[model samples]
Target: MGLLTIVTAAAVAGAGYVRARDAIVQRAQDNAVIETTNRVEQLYPLPARVFDHAALERIAGRVSGREGSAIAYGDGISAGGMDPSVITGELRSLVSSGRVGWQRVSYAGAVWLVVGMQLRITADGSSRSSGVEVYVLRPFTSEIEVVNELARNAWLIGSAVLILALGLAFLAARGVLRPVRELQLAAWQLGQGDLTARVPVRGRDELASVASTFNSTASSLEHHVGELTRMEADARRFVADVSHELRTPLAAMTAVTDVLDAETASLPGVAGQAARLVNRETLNLTRLVNDLIEVTRFDSGTAALALDDVDVAEVVRTCLRMRGFTEVSASLPDGVRARLDPRRLDVIVANLVGNALRHGAPPVSLTLSVAGSVAGSSLEILVADSGPGLPESVLPHVFARFYKADSARGRSEGSGLGLAIAWENARLHGGTLTAANRPGGGALFTLRMPLGGDA
Candidate 1:
């Protein structure tokens, strides 16, 4: 826009400069013509005598020798075979009744103002043929020089005006566009899930109004986000309280159900069958409630890590043993030890193995390796399962709380909070949890934990 404005202004200024210079030059030419006529009338006197063509030519020659004169003529006959004169007798015959007029013409590449006048006077008390036609010419070069100088100055002034206007227009455009750039950046941040983005109000104009509106929108978004976080916290707290309350009754129910199952061998009726179903369901319910309470504790920020130097290979074997699994293969290095909370490490391994076992095929591979640091080590604990890998849609949000891959397929025996809790535990230990599809066909869960005691 700035370049366009500069170009337009220059064009207009150039055209105006040309028009003004032309008009001025033309007026100078007109004035020169008028001045020449007036000066000729004042400087030369009309002669009176009965002169022939030769006498008239001699007198014209004398007058033409004067300064600022180009051509002069008289009306008479010449001596060369036929009568000859610039303003000849035949030409004078055409002006018998009145004085002749003058005209402007070009000669020798210069403008000339020509004046022709009929001279009439009495000589020796006799009105003889003494009047002659006289002409005087003046050059307009001096006047043209003045006009050219004025045109040069006009061009300079026009250039200056154009440059000034262009600079001012550029500044105005930048001032208007700067705030728009800031607003664009703020909007980009907001789209990337940064709700705190806002623009500052600068003045009491339309742009300022826009800034005010943007700030109001950001404020509303922040308020709603805070409200949602509070509601989520309350919901988790309720789940935690309810799960704790169910623990007492579930413990008693588990003991009673166990006694009934032991007497199943003595009975062969519907009552024993119903008792076995009840016992199985109660045990599943107890595990679900325990998972819920653990997740709630993590959400409420009450979870803590008790760090200790422990061999990672032992941790993996212990987790597998707790789930009644023995045939394990590991690529754990000898000194692959980590400073981590042993109990949380157990939970992370348990959840990852349980998830893989349910959704994947057998012969899961567990790898514990040391890399990246010697003094303050980093451990990579990878659990790879042979199953259909995670679908693309559910890969990114696999660690989100209560987010099931296929909710309509009914919940798995392992609660959805398992992966969520594992992810939280990894973060608490200054680590990260990642999942990806294996090359052959399966999914791999990797827990990368920082092994420094400070973490």
Candidate 2:
């Protein structure tokens, strides 16, 4: 805006100055030409043919009565208050050839418009040069003053226009930019989880329209989010209540199954088979119930770290031994101690290695190593197998609860929540669990736990 104003002002001022200057110059030339022609006509035939000093002075006085003075000279006679040098050579040449001519020249530290004309002699029906000439020297001082005044006015007006334009541009920018800045800050707050963030709308301009639309969208988002949060809380409460209600009966059933298991070998064919299957199913039911309760605890945010400084190698070995994962290969580095929940670490290891042993072929391998320096150190546990790798379609959902890669395997021996629970535990420790395919073959599960107290 400012640039456009400057260019427009400069062009207008330049054009105004040019026109004023041209008009003044044109007026000065016109006046000089008219005065010289009229004086020559009045002194026609060159009074007395050849002039003495007094007669020449009379001709000078007649020609020079206007705002400027003049000179009249013919043969060896000349008279005037102004210098003859004010008439240029070019003007003198044209006039000496019996023509009236004019020119502008610099003279005596100022500009002069000079007009010269030679007297013509009339004889019979023809005319010829008489050698008597009159030259008028009109000063341009007043015209210069007029031009200077116009130029000064042009500068003053152009500057005023530019300043006014700048003031208007500043106001327009403030009106637009303040709203835009508010919108930006509100958007940032919304992204940072402030659902109540809103911008103030003013006027009925385009900026106001945009702000209104953003407020409408944010309000809808807040409404939907409120509904979802309430529903989620209710679901968690339902699961927690149901799991608690079933625990008592499940404990009683476990006691009955244990007694049945001991007497299974002493019973007859069908009863013996029935008792064994009942015992096995009761144990599986107990495991599933426990798993569901653990998931509820995670969802309710009641899960916490019970940190103990312990040897990581011993934890892994004990988890493997307790789970009868004896055939699995292990690379437990010596004396890698960390402040961690030892029970949670054991659960993480058991889930990953157990999944590998069940889903993959031996030689399954568990590798433990510390990554990064001591202050920022992290413990990484890698469990890999030599069977088929995870399907590409299943990799993205590998840690999702109850997500089975093969649909028919939904009722498989292992509960589907193992990886999900493991992931939750890793997150609770401020770490991560990831699954991938080994470069060589089969599936890989990696667990990383940060070492510092901040974890």
Candidate 3:
């Protein structure tokens, strides 16, 4: 666009230059013709009466002797190589009615300005046979000089116009591109997970409209995110409060069961059954309360890790012992150290082992290893069960809070919060937890942790 503007200015200046040069040339030519006529009338004064050839010759000789002057009349000055007599006769024939005449002539490939005036030369009061005519000539070089000056002025003006035009174009481009660059930066920030990023609205123009649109979108996105966060927080709080309320009664029931178990031998059948039911429900309620508390901590951004370096193999051994996985085969490498909050680590490992034991065949397996070689090392733990593998539909939501495979299968003895708590613990440690149906008829849960353990 800048180049095009400059070219357009140049074209306009060029046209103006051509017209100015032509006008200069034309004016100079007209002035030269007037000057020639004046010189002729001044040199050859008109007589009151007509004169013969002899009188005309005398007047022509007087005018020709002056510098930068010439004469052409009806006489021959043979030695001067100009026939004054021949030109004098033709001029007399044209000027018989007393009118001025002009003509353009060229010699030596150059144009000349010529003007003729009527001159009657009389020696006495008596009229002669004919009147005299005087002619003047000048080269067109003076007119050419005027045109050249015009051309020079035009060239300078064209250059100045081009420079000014380019400078303006540069400034305009910067103005337009500045807002676009801001929009680009805002878009990049939004893409990189900054939902609050927005462009500033400045003017009531197209760029302002773009900025307004971007700001509106950012506001909407922030509102939606805040709404979702509030909803989640409210749900977590409700669950935590309800679970706390439930735990009070369940604790009371558990105390009553303790008393009943003490008197179990005396009461025998029905008493034993009632105590078992109470004990089972008390355990379930306890698990539910713990899960609710953990979920609340996560929601309120208070979940924290008490990280310490411990051997992964040792942790796995402790977890399997606690969960009673005596028949499970375990593979672990030495020097596989990981930093983890012991309580959260216990929860993660206990859930993995419990889930496997409850659903797996006799040969459940646990594996632990360090992931990287020398510079960096991450702890990777895998628990695979040889149970009937999870279905495709269930695999996606296996770690979701309170998700169950099927209600028709009935609730398992385990709370659904176990895997969800494990997932949150993995994330709290800056680790990842994933589940997949194994190639064989089983399922696998893999947990990977960072090497530094500071996350």
Candidate 4:
């Protein structure tokens, strides 16, 4: 914008300068022509009456004294202060055509206005040339200087106007962009979880309308999010309450199932089979209730880590032994000790091995290693089973609660909460659990726990 203003102002200034120069030169020429014509009229009658060269030179000297001019008589004698050649051919031609004329010419690094007139007299009632030619040379350098000064002033004013316009445009843009910048900042804050973020409203322009709409939308979003958060909290509290409520009765039922398990083998054929079935179902129910309790603890933020320095390989061996997962193979480092929650680690291993045993093929593998540096080291555990690998669509949601890969098999041996509980336990120990397909055609679950004892 500033550049455009400067260019436009320059063009206007140039045009103004040209017009002003032409007017100044024209007015100067007109004044010079008038003065020369008056002098010529005053001397023409004298030259017409006396045709002698010496007398004409005397009269011309009297008429143009000290001025740079030239006079020519009919008999071809001439007198002037200016060079005779300074009277151009064009001017002489116009005078010979019996017309008063003027022209501007440059000579000796100076500008001059030349005016010419031809004198005539009547003889025998016919008009004939007396051949008294008068020409005047007037310096126009001073008038040109005045015009140049005006042009300089025009350019100066144009530059000042351009600068002023640029300043005003910047101020206006700043005023417009300030509110937009504020809106951008507010949007970034909102995206970063600042629900109360809002922009200020200033005026009744379109920008003000945008600000007002932004505030309105922010308020509505904050209200809706608050409601959603409250409802989620209520749902979690309800689940936690129900889990707590069921624990007492579930304990009594667990005691009854234990007694039945002891008597199942001694009972008759049909009765024994029914007893075993009841015992198995009762244990599955107990496991489900226990898993629900653990999930509630995780959700309520009450789950905490109890870190201990333990050999990771020994812990895996002990968990596999307790779970009777004898067919699963283990590849562990000799004495890979880490600062971790031993109980949580046991839970994670049990769930992964149990899931593999129930849903995966035989020949499961557990690999444990120490990873990262001493200052911020980690324990990485990979549990894989030689089963059909997880479907591509189900792999991402493997750790979600109650997600089943084989939805057609609605009644599975273990509760769906196993992997979810394992995932929460891993996170409680400042670790992560990720599931993927192993290259050899199996589901792999990897657990990484920070070994810094910070959990």
Clashes of each: 1, 0, 6, 0
Tens digits of per-residue lDDT for model 4, 1-455:
65776677778778887888889888888887777767666764443465677766665665563545656556667765666667788888988899988888897798877777877776666777776776767777888789879878888977787778778878988999999999999999999999999999999999999999999999999999999999988998887788788888878877887888899888899988887887777777777878887887898789988878888889889999998989989997787888888888899999999998888898899998878866677889999998998899998888999888887765546668889999988888878899998888999999998877565
Per-model TM-score on C-alpha atoms: 0.66, 0.86, 0.66, 0.84
- Compared with the true structure, the alpha-carbon lDDT of candidate 4 equals 0.82
* Candidate with maximal TM-score: 2
Report residue 165 deviation for candidate 1 (angstroms). Answer: 3.5
Off by over 4 Å in 1: 31-145, 152-160, 163-223, 247-279, 297-302, 331-333, 371-378, 386-400, 403-412, 436-443, 450-455
Ranking by lDDT: 2, 4, 3, 1
Model 4, stretches more than 4 Å misplaced? 1-18, 46-78, 83-135, 268-274, 300-302, 372-377, 428-430, 453-455
TM-score, model 3 to reference = 0.66
Candidate 2: residue 370 Cα off by (Å): 2.4
Q: lDDT of each model, Cα atoms only?
A: 0.73, 0.86, 0.74, 0.82
**How far is each candidate from the true structure, as Cα RMSD in Å?**
7.6, 3.3, 8.1, 3.7
lDDT per residue for candidate 3 within 322-345, as digits (tens), equals: 877798889977776767777787
Q: How do the residues 1-455 of candidate 2 rate in per-residue lDDT, one tens digit apiece?
A: 66887898799888988998998889888877887788778876543355667776777778876677878787787888878767777887898777779888898888777888876766666676666687878887888788889889989987898788778888988888999999999999999999999999999999999999999999999999999999999998888888888899999999999999999999999999999998988888888888889999998889988999989999999999998999999999888998899999999999898888878899999999999965588989999999899999999999999887877764546789899999999999889999999899999999988975245
TM-score of 2: 0.86
Off by over 4 Å in 2: 45-102, 118-131, 373-375
lDDT tens per residue, model 1, 287-315 = 88988888877778888888888987888
